[model samples]
Target: MQNEAQYKELKEWRSQHIQAYLTDNKKLNQFHDELMRKVFNKAFQTIKKQSGEPPCAFLWFVVGSAGRREQGVASDQDHGLVYETKSKKYETYFKSLGEELSFGLNEVGYPYCEGNVMSSNKVWRKSLEEWEEQLLEWMDSQSWESMRYLQIFYDARSIVGEEKYITTLKNKVHDFKKGHPTLLRRFLDNMMHVKKAVGPFGQIFVEDNGAHKDSIHIKNAAFMPYVNSVRLLSIKEGIHATSTLGRLSELCLLPGYKELKPYYENFERLLSYRVSLFKASTTYDEVHYLNIKKLSKDEKKEVKHILKNGRKLHEYVQKIIKKGC
Candidate 1:
């Protein structure tokens, strides 16, 4: 009974409803998550159909930024697999399934990590016992690569399978940090070298030449440094906060960190500004000059103040690292 216009309107309404449903529902965040989940479920179903062991035999974790729930719109996959000690026989099959899941997600939109940090990577897909040993080894040796590995592992959050695996991983990380406080200091030092936009003369830092010559490496310069600092602080204080904001909140309770409260507040303001700018740009390109022309005078002033505070926080952390704390 509907005319062509009515039919078109109804179709648009239905699409909007589906999009809203997906956004509101936790299960469907990224196209990759949905695709990977389906692939894993199908792999498990295939095993079940063949009267083989289920894939749920291991715990699956989405690590790094994704694990910390600070993923950008273009986040790549960073995941790990931890199977029970007794399920070692199915390691190859589980790893193969992980690779398949990675491939499927890549096809759906999420790109494969250039660092080879995906679940499909043999380094990440391991049994619980192996993971424990690897973690201990990394903690014992204070190499840059080892520290990076621990940083990723410490930020891990279980996405599927048993919860106890994540609990065990947390315990392991806590123990490692408690035993080797120096590693945390080392991590902080590495993070400080990753600079933000503002330069020494109070000028906005930018590339000198190329297509992205004047653009800011927002992830490397600003966000990653903040994320790493929060992570280092969290590990030192035995705080299990996964997100940067959550870590900042936890830091407020720690002694001698009461001054950090204002910094955290300013950090949120700056983050919001950056996110707004990113949305408006409609591209994942690096931000060059912040368009103060678009903002009111008051808004521009506030942004400048917020950035100044962020720099202060960075310098404070730098001192803490130098002091071996």
Candidate 2:
């Protein structure tokens, strides 16, 4: 795994990160960023050795948790590649490079994406022209599944190669969104399900079946409201920042706002809650499910309070977009 100097340094840093997280949880995100840079470099060296440096310019980007810089101890790979030019030979070169990049990271840690959202997949690897065309097609269709992938693209950040390649795509999305604002309704619609964190009776909605029986899905139930709502706002306002909190920070300055960014405040609290959940977990899978039964009376109250705020923020943002006011 440590075939390179950077990878060896990353291994040492990861060990220190594990120890430091005991005192401060925020350090984990920083470590993930450093780890990804090294991984990208490793991928590059592997490609250079095997393919003799890329024949053309390209960009490599990450999506999902790594894209958001919110990765926990265990995560999977969700990445893509965009080459500067499109050609049969160049595409062939990139297709091989994509496989090398994917497996190279897998060799160290991050498992290949279960959904095939990796560089090895054709859908995630393309030329700049193809990416722009694909984005336009997805936005035009306004389909839930298509829009979902579009949202994932919103989280993309370059790990290797020319970052402007990724920036151009982001700006294209922002530009397309400017003229077609009504798409907000469809975007809002796509975000409207599977976000249940609290019941109508003002209680935590724990799972009743499956392996996670009696546990709450912190990822969807708690985090998605903040993530999805901020994403919709970013799409509407054309903010390019990928993180949910970063999105909220940019939105808070919009011309007229009487309230303190409650959504922002609440999201910060939720991150702390997630850190607590991760600290107590013994396995990677356990990090997603918070055992609400373990929370004290006061902690339970705060959880419900945060849940209620999330629902309110999402509804408020939806109304704002719907009115176009």
lDDT to native, each model: 0.65, 0.78
- Model 2 gets an lDDT of 0.78
**Model 2 CA lDDT for position 158:** 81
Off by over 4 Å in 1: 1-51, 86-88, 280-307, 321-325
lDDT of 1 at 300: 57
lDDT of 1: 0.65
Tell me the alpha-carbon RMSD of every candidate: 6.8, 2.9
Q: List candidate 2 segments past 4 Å from native.
A: 1-16, 22-26, 257-260, 280-283
Report the C-alpha displacement of residue 299, candidate 1, in angstroms: 5.8
Candidate 1 Cα deviation (angstroms), residue 276: 2.8
Residue 261 deviation, candidate 2, in Å?
A: 1.0
lDDT of 1 by residue, 56-175 (tens): 468878877677765544456788788876365577677666776576555444568877888788789888888888888887876788878888888887777876877787788788
